[model samples]
Target: MLVPTAAGTPAAPAGSPADTAPSVSASTAVAQARSTEVEEQLARDPGRFRVLTGDRPTGALHLGHLLATLDNRVRLQDAGVDVVLVVADYQVITDRDDAGDLPAVVREVVLDYLAAGIDPARSTVFTHSAVPALNQLLLPFLSLVSVAELERNPTVKAEAVDAERRQGRGMSGLLFTYPVHQAADILFCRANLVPVGQDQLPHLETTRTVARRFNQRYAPTTGYFPEPEALLTPSLTVLGDDGAKMSKSRGNALELRASEDETVRFFRRARTDSERHITYEPERRPEVANLLRIGAHLAGTTPGELADAVGAAGAGRLKTVVTEAVVEGLRPLRERRAALAADGPAVVRDVLARGNARANEIADRTLADVRELMGTMYS
Candidate 1:
């Protein structure tokens, strides 16, 4: 039997409602519902299922993040979709006004992805520096999304207002305009699906908005910018040990590259209450509940099963179990990374070559359509 979590606690994980499978017929009755669910989950895109997603090269990816981006990237590739992972090396300047680690950061970030099972051959992972035309598309998109619109953007507001309130460098124009670059990233390749977290819906919304407006204004009225649909990830909002958002800058992230020693230390410092038992109750036992959740995820069992396995050990032992599970879980990543980083420069170059070739072929067609719509078509 599952040990009781603290009383009155909720069971919903982030991005997951209490509802899992709704009571509905899987026959004719559910066809519309299923279709809508799919369209809502993915854009009812008639074009290719190419998925475009990228990261700002500010830091390394953590396990909490791997549960979202890296894993999803691999899944989309297996489904026969063209997947492009963009290394937003240019946008690093938005958060910090420095160029100190630009090349090093890009190199490290690429190696981290390779280590994390982001295959360069099966999927195209390339740095922004390698693709110049992508940035060029930004000029047009910038003209579409207004400053007021960008200001109202929840992400920019969170970064600039909420974060800057703590006395860091305030948000810059580049950060506010990062979405334009993102639109360029997707539309440059005419991507059809973009996988992202819930928080970035506004950014993706802006991407779609830019595509619509740009195609209306510049592309063939039939459209050049494929209004990219979002492939909403199932899990998001993975909490830090502190019970807040997970981020490297917040000092709240545990990197995928963390040594076993490092993983053990981080989990040990994770906050918990005076409650003496281990439970999966998130509402009442949020801190400990999150630990159990992560452990369940890495250990390949339900929280209920893990609770039973760690039976009666309470929070201290639960932490130990989670710590060990994470270390073992990430060992493959560490080893694969070591092998790749030995020839890191070559690996990055090859990824870029493949991505550029694929991206350019699509970009050329999209641009031609844009010129035709804008009446600049070279007859």
Candidate 2:
């Protein structure tokens, strides 16, 4: 059975949320209910909602991205929602100033999106740098949020701590206001639905706060900005081979670009318990359970079922099954990516060019509305 950690106690292991105590707060429950309502509304009339979600171009795409946001993005796009994907290239500097491989990483990210079924024709894909009007919303949005509120944001706090620990540098000012920037990303396009996990609720809440404050202050009756709703995703943490959060920098992740042989070798070396009898015990046997979870995700079954299938077969058999499942599951993506990559980065550039053009048109209109609302539209 899962146990809750006491106050001041260490956090539960990654991917084992049930082992941690539940807050069970009324506000949280309300948010969940609202998310459910938005989800149902979206299903009935997807044309009514616009979704804004993206990733920072830190590295190659991994399985973690697949199970988390990428798949959800595709699902939403297929449902006929207006999906706007931002390659958060500018946010990468919030932690480090490394632009050496930024361009390459951005191209790879676009390639990954295409390979994962985010049709360029159906969904808009653009970069942060290309959208100046979007960033302009930052100044006003920043004013809407106080320093205390920004600092209080758990996502910003955790990211700042992570950056300091990993890079041995203090958090950048941009990093401090990262949530506000995200608010801009969502509000600039007037996106009404944002796909987020529990950890990201703080950021989305901040966005909603900005929208509410702006409407109350300037566009009172107009309600110029829609307070975006969170489309909370099913929580399924995909840990790395080292039994921690799957990360590209940690070298424990299985990249979507990994070859079949690489996939096998990587999973073969995954950290697993020595017990010959396999069991799906996330609390006690996190690593084993993590593998089971990955295998089950790819095999379209529950982790318990995968564990039962691998019972007494040992970690070797389990690893083999998971690795093969991954290879088979990712075969189509790899093939499509290979074909897309053969065309070089030009194709991605063209897609971004088109996306940026479309985004600029939308941003210009949004900014015009903002200026008129604030009585600053002299032009």
TM-score of every candidate:
0.81, 0.90
Candidate 1: TM-score? 0.81
Instruction: For residues 1-379, write the lDDT of model 2, one tens digit per residue.
Output: 1111111223223235422324537546756887888777777888878889999999989999998889899999999999999999999888676766889999999999999999989999999999999999999888887888887888677876787677457778998999899999998998888888777787887887787777767865546787777788977788887778999878889899989998988898889988999999998998998889888888899999999999999999999999988999899999999999999989999999999999999998988889998999786
Local accuracy of candidate 1 as per-residue lDDT tens digits, 1-379: 1111111223233223222222323322333333345444433332246778888888778877787688677666665667888887887787776767676777777888777767777777777776666776777678877888787777787787665676746677778787777788887877767776455666766776776666545532244555655555654556776768778778898888777888888898888778776777777877877777788877788877787777677788988999988888788888888788787588776767887676666666766666666677667
Model 2, residue 58: C-alpha shift (Å): 0.9
Pairs of residues clashing in candidate 2: none
| Cα misplacement distance, residue 1 of candidate 1 (Å) | 42
- Tell how far residue 244 is off in model 1, in angstroms: 4.0
Error of 2 at 77 (Å): 1.0
